[model samples]
Target: MSRENTLLSASNGGPKQSPVRSNSSDGEKSARQRSQTPKVEFETERVELKKSIKFSGALAILLGNLGGASIFIAPTTILSLTGSPGLAVLMWCVGGLVTLSIAVSVCELALLLPRAGGPYIYTLQVFGNIPGFIILWGFVIFIGFPSWALAAYTGALYMLSLVYPDCPPPESAVKLLAAWLLVGLVALNCTYTSYVTKLQGFFTMAKASAMLIIIISALTTVTSDHTQENLKHFMDNSNTDFGRLCLSVFAGYFSYGGWQIITVLMEEVQNPVKDVPRALVSAMLIAIFLFVLTNMAFYMVLTPNEALQSDAIAMTFGRRLHASLPYLLAILVTLCCIGSVNVVVMGQPRILYAAACLGHMPRLFAMLHYKFLTPWPATFTMFLGALYMLLSGTVALLINYISLYVCIMLLVLLLALLHLRYSHPDREQPFKVPIPVLIVQVILTFALISVSVYEKPHELGFCLLILASAIPVYIVFIYWSNKPRAFVHLVDSFTDFIRKLFLLELPTTYINNHR
Candidate 1:
């Protein structure tokens, strides 16, 4: 039946109609509706739960999830660390493919578990509640949401440069401006999630096109003596420190981190089972091409030193046309980042709403905005948190924290994949990352382990928190689940007992009436 028909049929009886549910004869419902049951029955198809994601849409989600800040920052890190252009470039290629393999594994998991929490959902399912909740909040506050807000702030500052190059907004003003950006993007998400999603897809094309144009211009450089030396540096692999190059290329590899964002949106995505794998592989391929070409262009025109120095490198790239080109680059960056900013603005709140759905947060967040059909409470709270990030100029710290958060969440997901591989041996999948991919995933797990050990010692506490939430969940399940505490249950049980007693009376007393 059509969704409209079903809703209408379900609603025809008036206010209580939605809850009337199926007849006991329907059989499908008999398992759900006994008064003492623990599970709740949703009347709607919730087919959104089953729908697969599309290719373009998946790519859009992936980019919206990861595209912004990394592209701009990685090149600087690449040259600073590797110094060998060949080694640096090679790592990016290898990293992209390895990342793609990871993406493939995530897609497999998404198909198996298409829950709203994405990685959080997968984690909770495999690892249990505590780890899931910890990972959940970690992304919501510290990393996934805030980075996008900071990127928007970066855009706004770049935009303001158009008018006042001599005096870009002061530090205080930047904070205030970032706050406003955070609020504005939140407002955009408030308008409607579906609209924001469409906007993200649209903006991805624009970001890609603008980047392509700029990179093309850079690659087609007019050589001066200054440019020649930088060109020679890239081609001359002999003097490049190979060890440093391996470590140095991390910048570019890290830049590619967001491609796995598909894992986050697996639930809302239409036909995710079919679309996710395709979208992930495609986004990685496109991002790989873009990364190489953009870097080539960045190096072709400017030397390594110039790239490291410029906060707004595109401005310098534009200067090739005229001194006024920085203004245009500023405008482009501002607009594109706004698009990316909106993506995060829209993405993170779903995690919160998922929290509510799973009984962590208050249920109000689970309510769809009556008009917008988005999670109004969750989106609003996310905006407020982003505002906090903006005011504190804590973007730097937030980035550090969030990077750790993402790493932990990823580890959870990798483990989740392994769980599914063993747990559901009978299930057939349309797509599987080849066995070699599993080996790569094991290595990625080690990378995450190394990062955690070598870098963030504090993350273990968060994972411990994950373990912590489980205790309360267990307690709640034991204490309250089967026997709900409320006058409603009292009235309900009393009503059932009274009705049964009256039914016995009917058989005896109605004997006279029947005669």
Candidate 2:
């Protein structure tokens, strides 16, 4: 057949082109046809996270996260450093203001890019991949695991206190209890997210009620038994120095640390642009009220020296109410620790998942449970890390290592807001933090870093060392290994093993798309 005839026949589906064609024109025509064909691009399937969390659930998370065991522990540290309830209260208020300012900046970022990983997403999007990876590494190693471990540890200690009020429990028993608590919470979160949210809601209400009862009883029933000498020294500023006051502020800031966790679950929130920011502000306001009032309640019954002397200030306050009240207070403190631990476990895995999706980490961390619609692998990974930390008994060391990095992360996030302002000037920001608020936050973050470094140089150095350690990891996993296909394949096999072992059904859509 002639070349033109052959092309016409093929167009009409009459006959296929024969392989025996000899004309040079046919070869050129075939090349032209191939060049004109459009490319077919395949998109990787996305794992859909369940949006079962609502405003109330998110508020509960925020409340639970902010009212960690730190509140019970930090008051004594603040009081010891400040030496006056009045100054400590002022520091609390000031710390809340500083944190709220930073939260406002985070709110703006969360609204702009409402995804998982919270500050990691913000820093990643604004800065770039390396900086983002650093943040993620810091979170996994420093922020998430250590915080969860500490909460579990504190909860275990408080639970033991109920049984052994006179003497401390053995280290082995405490470690075992902490390990069980950490594992149980992780399993709950991995199995079902709805139950986790509901549990958080219940704990939030229970703890808030307990706190309100303490506040009311102290204000109404306590006979203002604070000594005249304590009152005379209420405004005492004799021991106050810049560094000491800064340390008190740091303690208060640590208590107020978890408010920004709302951003970590932005994807699961029903209304990210609206509810997340609202929850952030409302939760912080509620936390500040409870913190100040709880501290005031302590001062109402105990002198400054008495408050400073006790290891557990909340128990001291409760003991003054009634000798038997301390036991009840211990239970409340345990609940607070559990709630905080739950929040940490639930939120931190999302950071790993986010990083994995972005190719900053192994793909296994990004896999969601086929049935539960949760990041099971990431959650399990975090659980293992937390368990290791609990076993090692380095909770305090991990916390100190993360503290400076936390400050640096906050500073970077604020600077990220400023950077995004100019770089993506037209991006939609449903909740815009005023320039003054951002500026104030940046200044405050710098001051906090400077003060922290000046006050605790060794701690700052250790944290910096921990952060710097991420460089080698990033080089190996991302920069040098080039394509991580082997790693990804291994991860997928492990995920499949987990699914089969757990007897969970794979998602129909994922199966279809993969096939």
Candidate 3:
């Protein structure tokens, strides 16, 4: 096919080909047509995602993911690693600013290609099949959903804390709760996009309120308490170890990680050109303010050793302020984790759907529900992946693996941004980031990955092993055209069954004018 025709096919839905008719008797033809009627009906029905998300919804999606349990939990890790209250807070500010730069640069790409897949789509368009497939496989399949699994697990643990206040919850109970949360949220997402979007706004507000409560509580105790002593010598006993500092900064970076997901839902936003940039910048600023103040509150309310020793930093901070406050904070933190899972289920499937539409993944993933116009198949795919990770009991290792994997993904994406700029200078880009900002982002990413490896060299091997696993899957399922007939037919039958079961149909792709 010509480039124009290929683009046309994708925009229409998928690759379009002429149907072949056989020279069979009328009775035989009728029998075959009757047997294939459902498949024909499934292919004929098409739809698009509703453009219902405005600035508030867009900000909610970004904040919902950005202000996850990480903020409440990671401060202790950052403080412990840096061993200095001031240095730890500085790391948070630095991570926020660096991440802001990356977000704006991604805004440029989002504007250039206003699509659903975000980086996956950009990498596919800028690079080629193998690179794109690697991103979809390694990032979404390996890193994305597994991170959600970790969130669900954390949420479950916090939730169970309310029930078992004196001790911990059973491992089996935590797993069961996490699984139920995943199942319930996926159902919500598959039912209505607006339902999940509205939930994001509500949960984000709850998270912000929890932080504000902590900040205000700290301020009220200022005159009576000696918490200020912790920050008196801000840089005292600061760790100078390069590896540990890198780990600390990366922890801070993880708290600011979810802003990039905003670009993935450009197609669903009401006004992508204006609202996307507005929401991205505004959400980052708000998140940074909340995180910095909340950390200051932690150090102000509790001693450094107290803050470092506590397993749940926010819960401990609440308990120090009031006997009953820890219970309230636990509920809020659990909601934050649930909100993270909500946004993950909301956005990540779109990446899979986009890849499937491009023939990089199974076509079933490209299908949308007839009634809801949502990507049920892809969402279910994420649920299954997360379920596997949850049951395997390797979530902690996956979390570590994901941190490194995310840095590598971001570095490659930044390089892809540079490649697009010089290689396609003539292409229209409305929101251009400064050259220095891009340089800083690249340098910071490289430093993090390098130091992380220096600290734990074996992690690099595990990360590589996970990433390299994608290559063989791609070569077998996607790269090779001559798949076995029976195997292909079995896959097709399975896909057809899923489509019928969920009442799913292909969705039309929106190709922006610039691309």
Scored by lDDT, the top model is 3
Clashes of each: 9, 0, 0
190-295 per-residue lDDT for model 1 (tens digits): 6656666766777677667767777767655646665567667775643355445434333433567666456666666777776777777777888888876777
Candidate 1: Cα lDDT at 367? 42
| lDDT comparing candidate 3 with the true structure | 0.81
- Misplaced by over 4 Å in model 3 are 1-46, 510-515
Which 10 residues in a row give candidate 3 its minimum summed lDDT? 1-10
User: Model 3, 257-372: lDDT tens per residue?
Assistant: 88878878888998999899999999999999999899988888888888888878888898787889999999888988899899888888888888888888888888887668
Ranking by lDDT: 3, 2, 1
Q: In model 3, what is the error at residue 39, expressed in angstroms?
A: 19
lDDT computed for candidate 2: 0.76
Where in model 1 is the C-alpha error above 4 Å? 1-54, 222-225, 235-253, 455-515
TM-scores of the candidates in the order shown: 0.77, 0.86, 0.89
TM-score-sorted candidate list, best first: 3, 2, 1
What is the C-alpha lDDT profile of model 2 across 28-109, one tens digit per residue?
Answer: 7777545433211011122367788898999999999984867676566677777778888888888887778788787887
- Estimate the TM-score for candidate 2: 0.86
